[model samples]
Target: MALTYTLDNARSLIAVALIIFISWLLSENKKRFPFFLTIGAIAVQAGLVLLLFAIPNSQAVLSGVTAAVDGLADASDRGAQFVFGYLGGGQSPFATVPEGGQLPFIFGFRVLPLILVISGLSALLWHWNILKWITRLFGLLFEKTMGLGGASALAVAANIFMGMVESPIVIRAYLDRLSRSEIFLMMVVGLATVAGSTMVAYAVILGPVLPNAAGHVLVASIISAPAGILLARIMIPEERKATELDYEVTLKYENSMDAITRGVQDGVMVAVNVAAFIIVFVAFVGIVNNLLGLAPPLNGEPVTLQSLFGYVFAPVAYIIGIPWEEAHAGGNILGVKLFLTEFIAYIDLGNIPADAMSERTRMILTYAICGFANVASVGIMTGGMTVLMPERRSEILNLAWKALIPGFMATLMTAAIVAALPAQLFGG
Candidate 1:
């Protein structure tokens, strides 16, 4: 028992050390690595993972809270049904699919509209100041624990429930005022975390296949937030001590009706953008794969982009504690998420053959791929922030790719933390 515990701890520590070492290697000011801050950040992330999955009392409470994420998906379905009708919203008029027949989820109808409902609800929550209050509570934690500037902490906390670009909107006033490191940290944090509004769609797709998938996704977002801050600081140390900025809260609706209207409007735009991106990007991948397929066979099969990505990222998979043999499979998902986005990655994961990934590898990936980390996120975040603070657009562009470094680092760090835990902890 003691030996097993020692080995687990050693592997986990090594994973973290490797991540920090590599991040430090890329630091702009290599001499200024924030050792204590890095340690504190990792400790906090590890503690949160433990509380959610290892401690009985904390796990029970968190399970109840995260279970509500799944409930939100159900509620969104009811709303989706009202607008799109039964088949469109994915509620079959008949109770079951005919044997060997299909009721596969339709993305346009079933998955896309959940973003709308969540946006409207989010707008109303903002109007009521509920989200601000919630964000402030978390903001305080990061501020104290990580000694981050006020605006930076607030943005990171908001990333827990908001999308990458949307989380920074709350700090728009301070956007221009923030130091370079602070702005970069905010961007990376945004890319590193998934929005609450989008989690509903993810839950619907993954819930049936993975046990308590929503809960795990929720935990992944939470743990990734601090990791973003920590890695951001190490990779690009903040030169100036943070001064508390007067937070100007802007995400409010004039009234109940206004909230709903704005929410739906925002949701519509988001859904449209999402659909368009998926349509174009998926087609792009298909075209690219076909082109790659023309190449000579590797092993017994033609070389596809997906397999290439898997082989490329296989080492990262191994570092994150996936078993040696399964690392290639795990790398494929990690690569997909990094190259494309978690949306496509989750879709691939949901549709994989039963034997594609071991149960333990599946668990690690359910956490790893829960973020907005992708190559495109840099552009999305840069464009979004440029609109809010055009004066700093150049700086935003400069740090765009830099943001991806810690953005992915944060999420992958979370995956490694989970990978280090005993299989028994997750009921393997």
Candidate 2:
């Protein structure tokens, strides 16, 4: 035990147990809790982690995947530079504060454009049947092990690569057929993983802070899918057998160009919404912080929203293997992710001084916040589901609240899994 793992990792395993217990406690049908389902879901995560991190051969393969993703982000940068010039990392006319220092990156010009390129490329891959085969392979795993019906299994698998609302489009005909539990699972898992387009963008933002950032986020998304499943079942056990056991991918596109065009259009909507939310939410936080500043000082510092949130989530941070000294900062990032946005949380993470937290804690946090889980996502999921099944609008709205905690817990569960493993697995 001492050689293969560290003492700190035990706390993370305990944290996972606590999360499971809490989910079981909150279950709508505790007596009907799916023990094997939980075990299977957990096993899937542990297996993937071992394959990707524990084994030398798999680690090299994982590295190759990450390198490919990094290359894709670099390709996106080329497109941005061509259009936005120096602001997008082209030669700069202005002088730097330090000689030969590169110009500061402008987020709109350099980063967000990755969404457009990646989204279009993803659509092209789907058109070529590449993603469909990948989705099917993963879907089969969930279907056989977790006992999810075929449609729900595929959607859950697709959530690893598609947006919450977008994944359901592949199983549109079966939207009305899903059980209440399955519907809630869909909502939670959707919130638990990120869209394929934003995954690369986030990796770019945190590249400096986290080595193999793209790989970690991608692995995090995959791990969170099953974590979400386990929590969803514990919270809302299957009331009836899932009706989607036998399913096929129904989503299609005409040609490669059409795929690219439609994907870019979808990417535009996501990019715009992301930009708008960042601007508005940051301003809103500032206004709230100003109001909080009016309060009396605590510990020689004026209390602000981040501090308050830090106080709330600090214990959670410690449980997930972050040292107590840095828990407050870690907690603040978690609070930002749950309440505002993971994108903002990642940005805040980038801004944190390197010396403030150990690399392991930073890696723990990188996986922790790599999801779409937030208050806003509840709205997105509900709205998207309602559009797909207008008849279930009221039920969807009602289940929206039930799914929120599970969604948030899913990523935390992923973090706990990361924390439980030896730091050596992450090259720390």
Candidate 3:
């Protein structure tokens, strides 16, 4: 057993090494990159993954927290049921069976409302200063260990709880003082992690397939914070003469009532935006797939855009610990995820046959798709930052693509770290 475990770990390490090499190879100023900082970041990521996956006690605690979050999903469903009645949370009204079985996979009905509940909770927590304190602690730790400084670290830390859109507000007052590298780091971190409000929604989506769905998503976002910053620095090696530094976090809520109200309003917009985006994006994908379908069919199946993506990214899936035979399927998921959105990719995942993917492949893909690293996020980041610091609009536009490369790479590194762990983390 020990020998088998060691060999599996060796394979995982090779894959991780590949990911790092690929990251370095893409470095803009390779000579200027602080290699030691990159190494330390990877080491920290690996250690944290072990603490979350290999250690029974810590993993159990995370699993318990996931269960609690899962329960929140259940509670949200009940609330939806109360409002939308049968269509709300009542077993996905889009069944395609002769007997009309409950599909339970409608995005608008099942996933949108979750944004409202968790968003409110996050707001209440922030109003109570719990989130601020936690971000401060993590920011200081990142400053001391990763040299990310206070403001950049705090914004990244806030990405853990808030959505990418709201996190930059934490460091809004210091935007002008930030260096170009710091801006890229902030954008990548945002693009690389999802908000707490939607984490529950994604958790609800993946829960049926992954028991520790919330736990895994949480771990992916947290680890990707450091990984994202590290890769950003590597790709666009910090060019500032001195350093971008800010330690003050002066933002505060007016009151608990105000927080709850604002939180709900923001969440409603998010839910509506998500619903429309998913609807439109899914339709667009179908249109593109149809256009690609005009190509010759292969193996009795039409050659669609998804198949083309699979062909390009299959090698990536294989190296990341997916079984070889299933690599094509995993590759398609990665493409749809990066090109479209994880929301749709996860919907694709839910439909794939369980026998087609091994538990290991499933676990790796789960973490990989946990982030907001799709093409849409690039525009979102560009627009958001342009609004926050219009003076740096030129800089934000130029590095948007640069930040995106590492945004996805950070999640890949997270998946690689998870790949090294035992299958028990995936749960039964």
Candidate 4:
């Protein structure tokens, strides 16, 4: 039994390592021996795992992040109550809606409003130059630590708050001049991590399901950054000359009201797109599953698409340390996230039985699936990048498929780390 367990874990690690190596080899431009690059990638991947275990107070980081996210939720709820009064359904506001006085449409409503509130607040912070300063600090760190160019570093730093495409606009002037490797890195990082704008909505969705989930999500993004960079480099070695040290922090808003107005518009578009995509995709999935369900069964039971995904990805889930019994259940969530949207996967996760997944498995899955790396995201990247730099549209289109592999691998690397660590490290 002990030997079998050891072999299972070893196989899991070897599988992940091979995936990373193959991704690097296929993506690399320079056919030279990738000895150092592979080592560095492994080191960065292993470092994140060790940091979580070695640090004595790692849970403190998760705890602080949870408190901050909870505080944001509370503040948003308070503001919603103030603006909409009882109609907003804020803090027991629903009970007082006058016995028979038409209850407000509540489904798919409470959580989305938080997006608008967060958008407004984020704009206010940007307008006040607070966000710019923070971005600069992170940008400087990345530049110094990872040896990235000014524009690439800024885009990476800005990615923590803004979307992948939106972050590049920070250094829009340099997009034309950025090397192919840098461009790929930016896109991979974007797919591997979440933006702050949508973090609140994700928090609201996952917080109730997974304890300290909000913090874990945040940490996942941060830890994934280094891995993203390393993987990008391994795949496409920097062929062009690197940019020099020219860090300029500036908020290019026309004015405060414009910033707020633009932010609101962006937020509304995102919300509508999210709602529309979920409706269409979920319906499509249901249709496929229904059709499959009608087919002849092999095991005296009707087989469906969900079951296929569950079985196909079950091994992957197990490798990530989910229990044998619940591996398929967890894999189904991941498979859904990759095919559809993370938002949809998250909603499904929230609905899953608490007993279905162990706490560590849940946390690792949360980190793994927290990205915009679905099939649809490729379209988004191509469109957004073309708009930013039309000259590179061909390159962006050509590289989109290649980018997905590393993007997926980046998140998997994060999950591998979470899985390899002891449960106590993440406060599970």
Q: TM-score winner among the candidates?
A: 2
Q: How accurate is candidate 2 locally (lDDT)?
A: 0.86
lDDT of 3 by residue, 1-428 (tens): 13135454456668777766777798877778677887788878877777776666776887797889878888888888889876665654555633465544567766888899888888888889887788788777677778877778888888877867888887788888888878888888887888888777777777777667778878887888878878787777777542444544445668999888888987997787677778788899899988878888877889888888888988887777677788899899999999988888888876777676776687788888778888877877787779888988899899898777788878877887777766664452
Candidate 1: residue 152 lDDT (0-100): 83
For residues 1-428, write the lDDT of model 2, one tens digit per residue. Answer: 12367766988888888888999889888898787987888898988887778776656776787788778877887898888877787677777534464567678887789888888888888889999889989999999988888888999999999888789888887887898888899988998899999888888888777777778888999889999999998898887778754444378898999999998998897888789888988999999999989899988889988898899999999998788898999999999999999999998998787777788888889888988889877877787789889999899999998888888888998998889888877777
Ranking by lDDT: 2, 1, 3, 4
lDDT of 4: 0.73
Best by lDDT: 2
Off by over 4 Å in 3: 1-3, 6-8, 91-103, 241-248, 424-428
Once fitted onto the true fold, the runs of candidate 4 whose alpha carbons sit more than 4 angstroms away are 1-12, 28-30, 33-58, 78-107, 249-251, 298-301
Model 2, residue 34: displacement in angstroms? Answer: 1.0
Cα deviation at 336, candidate 1, in Å, is 0.9
Per-residue error (Å), model 1, residue 339? 1.3
TM-score-better candidate, 1 vs 2 = 2
Q: Which residue pairs come into collision in candidate 4?
A: 27-235
Off by over 4 Å in 1: 1-10, 57-59, 62-67, 89-102, 247-250
